[model samples]
Target: MEIVTRADRPDLRETAAAVFKERWPEFVFHDEVPRRYTDRAEKYFGLFDIMVLDHGSVVAGGWGVPVPWNGAVGDLPSGYDAALVRAVEAREADIPATTLSFMAAAVGESHDKRGLATVVLQELTRRARDQGLAHVIAPLRPTWKHRYPTVPMDEYAGWTRPDGLSIDPWIRTHQRMGARVLGTAPRSMVIEGTVAEWESWTEMVFPVTGEYVIPGALNLVRIDVEQDHGVYVEENLWVQHR
Candidate 1:
């Protein structure tokens, strides 16, 4: 596989978008809000981000931004949406970035087991090092947490395997790469839509106010029929690459 950056190959923008959707269709719903800015040519669409191609087809990639992280995990944003806002704010404030904040890393289905994710991580870290950043921080959407929507994030993050590693595959992978789980972002990404819009997205009817467990949702979405709105606040693990 060959790695190419959005900065060098502007045409890969469409491919990168497609790969992201293919790898994460459900999560992509709320991503549109942040994408509005990150997708711009003058912003994060390039520069520090990159894509991997195998035989002319995109297989994996990583996206991130240099931000003014204070080296304190508690100061990290609680959600992916907030992180994006910080990225935009850093640019606007002309703040010199002291760390690289990774937002997303994806490997296509066809490219499974090829270790493309590792390549993406290496490149992301390499770029951060080249820029004199202290570390790479990630608000990881764990690979298998959606299976247990009712499990609290803090408890879930504490679950470990027989080998003393995190039970979450994504978190485990980060651990293997020398990243530590600093904490959990309780509201890492929040998506709000009208009850009708939620119905359209989930294809499920909400006849009353309650928490509805939708397929692919990492958490129970609150639907208030009276208010005609539904809200989903997703949680993620905060991991730091030193």
Candidate 2:
């Protein structure tokens, strides 16, 4: 299998979109009006490098990640995007230079085992390093990711890491790709522990969040979402060392 990384390639990137479509079906947004991560990725990924390959007869594969700080953490409305830009402008020093916020990489199932995911990630790290991006970061909500129903849009931004292994594998994946765990700050929902502990805590604590709801809006909605009802998603925030 051959791997190639790039800054931008419209033709190849267009083909790569097919993989993303499978991973992030349009139905996700069609079923839910707000259109989740894939929506954002499709809308904006054109601005970044699109890594992919056309592997002969089998299936084509590719993945895309943003430059620096382009991640739409959760429910990134225009205002939130604007605010984040402003914040970056205001505190350049506080946020590390190599902080690279990532979006999801769209890959095809047929292309599995070809090391396509690993290749794309390696390419992304190289490109990020070239651009002086210190780390590749991905921030996703545990609610949408951990099979929890969507957190109220209003409070969604404030929702921290919900406890569990919802995102640990991803971080470990990044570490495998050559990044360090600078820190794991507690978000409103996340917890730190072993796999067994994660399972137990998820069962025990997920329901409790409902009490904090405001009663009328989204917060009031039951977060005790049936695991089967929603799809499971995890955010992978990574920082690849130069």
Candidate 3:
């Protein structure tokens, strides 16, 4: 397998999209912030987007954007949405980037457990270092948090195994590569929709006004039947690589 940037192989964009569709949940595509800025980021920072291709087939991929950062943990962007916005605004404002904020990484379903995700991350980090960025950070969405939707992010991020590794598989993966948790972004990605839209996304019924646990959601979605609205605020843990 070989890793290539979007700048190197623009034709691979469609292939990468297929991989992402298979990796993320249906509702994830409906996040308004990402839906608005993703194309612009891709247009401006194509060099930072990468794909792992196995004999011309996309097996894994990751993407991030450069942004100015203060080098203080407390000053990090609120979460994924904030990071994307900063990156775009910095570009438009002609500010030099000081850090690379990794946004998303995924391995195709057929290629799971082969370490391709690690390869994609390593490549992104290497690119950041090559660009002379000071650090690489991520708004990490814990892989197992969806199973415990009611738990607070700060509490969930603190869970560790007997070996001193994070109990969440995705967090453990980053920790294995020398990343330390910085903090939690309680309102990382806020997704809102009407009751019908929520049902369409999750294929589950929400007949009452209450917090309901749904599949593939990291937090309970609050539904208001009387108002015909539903909202889901996902929390993410911030981590930085040394």
TM agreement with the true structure for every prediction: 0.93, 0.45, 0.97
Better of 1 and 2 by lDDT: 1
Compared with the true structure, all predictions reach lDDT values of 0.81, 0.39, 0.91
**Residue 32, candidate 3: C-alpha displacement in angstroms:** 1.0
Candidate 2 Cα outliers beyond 4 Å, as residue runs: 1-9, 12-14, 25-47, 56-98, 140-171, 180-242
Per TM-score, the best of the predicted structures is: 3
59-168 per-residue lDDT for model 2 (tens digits):
33343443334433442212212323433443444443434444445457776666566666666656666766655654322224323334333343334346522243
For candidate 1, the per-residue lDDT at 238 reads: 87
Model 2 CA lDDT for position 45 = 36
A best-first ranking of the candidates according to their TM-score comes to 3, 1, 2
Report lDDT (Cα) of residue 103, candidate 2.
40
Better of 1 and 2 by TM-score: 1
Which sections of candidate 1 miss by over 4 Å? 40-45
True-structure lDDT of candidate 1: 0.81
Query: What TM-score would you give candidate 2 relative to the actual structure?
Result: 0.45
